[model samples]
Target: MARILIVDDAKFMRMTLTNILTKANHVVVGEGENGKEAIRLFRELDPDIVTMDITMPEMSGLDAVKEIRNEFSDAKIIMCSAMGQQKMVVEAIEAGAKDFIVKPFDENRVIDAINRVLG
Candidate 1:
């Protein structure tokens, strides 16, 4: 398992994701309530992977992805998107995100994305 950072505007979403990852034997290094904090935590915490939500206060996840990619080119990022955001998902991949997970996450899907990206 790798060190993971969970970034989402919703407290409940962050908490839920944190619990899930932690239970699955991954070390959840930090959690971010917004993209700004997410970017700051990324540098401060230096986690092995990141799960970043699409919509949030201040910077959007897409902006954060670009910023993170600019500095940490080798960063492993998993964009968290909602269904029907196909274009945005494609943009995220173009911005260097490793993979993505859909909203209202399925445990198995999340794990699979993480595993595939990590490998």
Candidate 2:
């Protein structure tokens, strides 16, 4: 039941995330197509959690994670990536991501990641 923000470039990915999180009873506070908007909305909305895409236009999720963590050290962020982004995933974890989820996401995995991050 945490407030969550989803940041991803692809429309269908966003939609899939929204549906999955919504169905699990999490309030999706906002969705963004790029890291700049994601950062802006994260500050404005102050969600409990954020799911960030590793690759996106404008700003990369790694950069956004850095920026957000720069301001909000206590921020709860989950990095989402396609398989095989080991280096990026490691960087994101170092940048303060609570967890990472592999895409073409599974509903159960998504929910589990959310719960683990929130905890």
State the lDDT of candidate 2 residue by residue for 1-119, as single tens digits.
99999999999999999999989998988999889988999999999999999999999999999999999999999999999998999999999999999999999999999988877
Query: What is the number of backbone collisions in each predicted candidate, taken in the order shown?
Result: 0, 0
TM-score of each: 0.96, 0.98
Error of 2 at 11 (Å): 0.8
User: Per-residue lDDT of 37-76 in model 1, one digit per residue for the tens?
Assistant: 9899999999999999988999999899999999999999
Off by over 4 Å in 1: none
Clashes of 1: 0
Give the lowest summed-lDDT range of ten residues in model 2: 110-119
Best candidate, TM-score-wise? 2
Which RMSD values do the candidates have, in order?
A: 0.8, 0.6
lDDT of 1 at 89: 89
CA lDDT for candidate 2: 0.94
